[model samples]
Target chain A: MLQIKNLKATIDGKEILKGINLEVKAGEVHAIMGPNGSGKSTLASVLSGKPGYEVTGGEVIFEGKNLLDFSPEDRAREGIFLAFQYPVEIPGVSTTNFMKTSLNEIRKYRGLEPISSVEFLKLMKAKAKLVELDMAMTSRAVNVGFSGGEKKRNEIFQLAMMEPKLSVLDETDSGLDIDALRIVSEGVNKVRNSKNAFVVITHYQRLLNYIVPDYVHVLSDGQIVTSGGKELAYKLEEMGYDWVTNND
Target chain B: MAELKDKIIEKYTSTENLNNGEPVEIKHIRDKAKEYFRTFGFPNRKMEDWKFFDSKPIITNDFKLVTEKQEIEKSVLNNFLIQDLKANLIVLINGEYSKENSQIITERKNLFIGSLKEGMKTKPYILGKYFAKYADYNADGFTALNTAFAPDGAFIYIPKGNLLKDPVIILNILDSRKSKVLGQPRNIIIAEANSDVHIIEEYYSIGENDVFSNVVTEIHTDENANVQYYKIQNEEANAFHVGTTQVFQERNSIFTSITLSWGGSVTRNNLNSYMNSEGIECNFKGLYFLTGKQHVDNHTLADHANPNCNSNELYKGILADESNGVFNGKIMVRQDAQKTNAYQMNKNILLSDTASINSKPQLEIFADDVKCSHGATTGQIDKEQLFYLKARGIGEKEGKKLLIFAFANEIIEDIEVPELKEYLVNRLNEKLEKL
Candidate 1:
């Protein structure tokens, strides 16, 4: 579903992602575990076409098209979703209105008619339950005064609503408690299908236990040093990242 | 200054029977106001209150006082009316009341809706009691000028214990097609004890020729009265307007005002409210969106004179394409006005690098037991908020538009009238689309 060839990215004249390459197929979950400042979040940002990141030398192909040619909004319209590590608090913009606008824009890009108000309400209700989001939260301003767990759950709620082709969970489990982690991981597991793919980026092995990955890759010092099956995650959890970095 | 002063004196003295059938008291007041204007001529940047606003163009331009009423087609007049509002419409053309175009709800007793000149003839006692009482001619040059040339405008009076079934829509239309014209519209609204009323005052210019409007409105609220007032200014791009609104609140009275300015070459608004008695509440809100070399200045004041009075003030400005805006708000708590609560905030967003704003929120509290705070903020469109919206598949234009709308919506949501709120929302959207 996605391919990266020697992905080299820099920000402010400092190299972050140094010749990183990875591949993912349909219906598979891939876990990219790395220490702090190891370019895990940079990979997610570059793939999502975030501003202020200069791609020095690399190419990213998604679904048989070069993704670098599209703008951030166009990339979003092409079904690339990046759940932000910290969702912005937008006062005076209700969550329901934001979701409706986003959904209609995406639908327009796909050559589909706008959803009716009744159907939109029903969809919101159904998807909100999958993430256990309270209906009252949707009526308030977007993420204003929301707790950490609620913000993460709202991201999952958006994921369920968009139903994108490729989803990048960028540290989605950083601030979640045990209960919230279970609920968020369960929500992600429910949304997985044969036509979709996910790149779960985290710092710990706790989330992989809930949403098991088919492959695990160790990212250290701006490159992927080791790639193996799920057992690699257990080994890293048992012996920490030094085991792989020293071997490399 | 001398040339303009001589022209104004000639214009005032040349008119015949200017105060026909008026009492000697009103004539004396008019004479005093004229003397005040002659002494001040026009305010300059040297004055403290007039430092930010320059009246050079208004003073230098040769403006003919519009004495004769001009003819306007009914179709043109209908365009200025609020189409969906079921309110009493009072239309003034070239500073004169147009009887043929006005509609008054006459079934309600003790509700007066007509021209100020006619009101002077019929209800001279009430007009004389509160005509130029609230607005201080000595403090402001524009107020003094408007009072000196006070010819004709809307006169609204609601009697004691009466509730107005519909709002009063006062539309001032200027037809400056033949020559550069000057218009002074004086409005007086008095709500008696235990009464409720809503008034919406708007301005429109039909022709491209320069039109300078000097308007003053004085409202008096008796004990336990409630009044909601709105001022909408969307004149032509070449039009210059200076409007002053002074409201006086008695014991336990409630007064709220919202001033919205969208278009004009130079627009200056002075809104002041005096809380004379205890347990009064005064709220002032304003929003101005300017583009294309437009300049708007808003100066507001809330005077808490008695004990246990509260006032809240919020003003927002959005400037784009080299537009300039200024906001100066002051809250004063006198020595005897203990337990006073006053809050003031002014916020601005500049869309372009060339656009600028000067905001100053001042608070003077003499009473030691009062709680008063004021703040002002000026910034550009938040980039993180913009990126958040754009990353959700919304285009850059739509993203910026949404953020701007959201910023302005905080004030729009405070409007109590549904129709007016919806109208403002549509107008704001239209303005955002152009930006």
Candidate 2:
């Protein structure tokens, strides 16, 4: 469902993602583990079409369409979601309103009728229980004055709401506790199906335990060094990426 | 004043003659104002109050004083109606009073509202006593010029202990039938002790014509009286607006003034609040949203002359396109005004690189025991917040709108009037749609 060919990106004229090529089919969870300065987040940002990032070379194809030709909204409409490492705090905009606008915008782009308010509220209520989000939190401004765990949980809640085809989780487990990690992973697992996929990017193997990816890849200097099965995660966690990369 | 007299009598001649209203003219006061204007003529660039906003354009142009001789159509006044509210509408077409579209409810007691022509005979004593009492006639040149042509104005007086449940809305329409026209719409409002009233002055234009408006309003709040004054200026993009609002609060009185400026080519608004006695309080709030090539300059002053007085001023501006904004706020606490609590804050957001804002908050305090603080900030939209919204599938346009609205919600929540609050929010939403 996704293909990357020699993706080379830079920020402020400095090369970040040197060369990357990957392909993932449906119903697959791909875990990417890297050390500091491995260009993990850079890969996610370039894939999401963020401004100020120049793609010097290569192209990304998603669902048989050139992804780089689409605007950020168009990319989102085509079911491409990026969970930011650091969530933003938007004041004076309620989470419910934000979610509704986003959902309707995507629906309109797809030429589909907007979900009724009653149905939307019902969906929000049922999804909130997945991550154990409080109803009061949904009524307040989007992520304003929320704790670190709540922001990540809120991101997952949105992931569930949008139901994107390919979800890119970037450092979603950094600031979460054990219980929050469990809840967030559970929410992601609930949305996983035979036709959807997840690209889990992290610096640790802790989150991989709950989600249990089908493939594990190590990224170093903007390039994946090796690929293996689920047991490679435990091996990397035990010996660290430095040992593996040095041995290689 | 000599310069003004020479310019007005020689360069710009009045084409229309004055109306024969009761033949009761205050030549003595007029002469005194002229003499004062001679000493305090139009301010140059050196003056502190008129530093950023120069008055050279108004002085150099030959703007003839208008009268009610021109034909005015009813279609011009149709768009200025606040159709939803229970209001007493008073429309001024081309700086002249329009009685056909105005009506005053007589159910209220000890209340007097009429044009300057009617007030000349009905409430002469009240008008004579407090006509230009608190206005700094020598400081502003156009204010003196407005006083020289005081026939085209409004007079409002509410007696002690009277409450006006309905708002009295005054619409000043600057319709330029001839060449570039200039209007001087002056208003005098006096509320006695324990009286409560709300006044809203709206400035607008009908057609696509260039006009200049020079306005002044003198307000007096008696002891323990409360007044809510709101000024809404939505002139045409081809117009220039320069106005001054002077307010005097007595002991234990409360006065709140809010100005919303959305349109005009070049606009300068000056507001001053003087707390003359102890236990008095004042709140001055302003919001200006500018787009295109518009320039908005706001200068305000809060003078605390007595002890135990409090003053708060907050102004916010959102600039888009190539718009420029300037805000200068001055607060003074005299030696006797101890225990004064004064706060001032100015915040701005420049959406485009060409958009700019210059803000300066000044405070002069002679008293030692006072709490005063000031701050100013100018920046673009927060990218982190934008990313957060986008992560949730909200598009860029909707995300930016949410941030801008959130930036303005702090000030809108401060409005005490429910109807006005809703109206402001709706107007804000409409303007955001264009952005």
lDDT of 2 by residue, B1-435 (tens): 333346654432342234344333454555565666655666677877667775565566555555444445677676666656776767776676778777787455557876766766777777777777777666777677666565566668889988788787788888776666777777888989998888888898755557778888889999999999998888989788888889999999999888888988889998998999999889888888999988889988999999999899989899999998999999999999999999999999999999998899999999999999988999998887776666556678888887888788777876666776787788888788899
State candidate 1's TM-score. 0.97
How high is the DockQ of candidate 2?
Answer: 0.52
Please give, for residues A1-248, the per-residue lDDT of candidate 1 as tens digits.
89999999999999999999999998999999999999999999999888889999989999999999998888888988888899889999998988898998889888999989999999999999988899999999989999998898888898898898899999999989999999999999999999999999999999999989999998998999999998899999999988888987
Q: Write the per-residue lDDT of candidate 2 for residues A3-85, one digit (tens) a residue.
A: 98899998899888878888888999999889988889988888787788999998899999999998777888899989878
What residue pairs clash in candidate 2, if any at all? Answer: B1-B38
Local distance difference test scores for all models:
0.89, 0.82
**Per-candidate total of colliding backbone pairs:** 0, 1
Residue B350 miss distance in model 2 (angstroms): 2.4
Model 1 residue A106 CA deviation in Å = 2.1
lDDT of 1: 0.89
- Winning model by TM-score: 1
Give me the displacement of residue B321 in model 2, in angstroms.
3.5
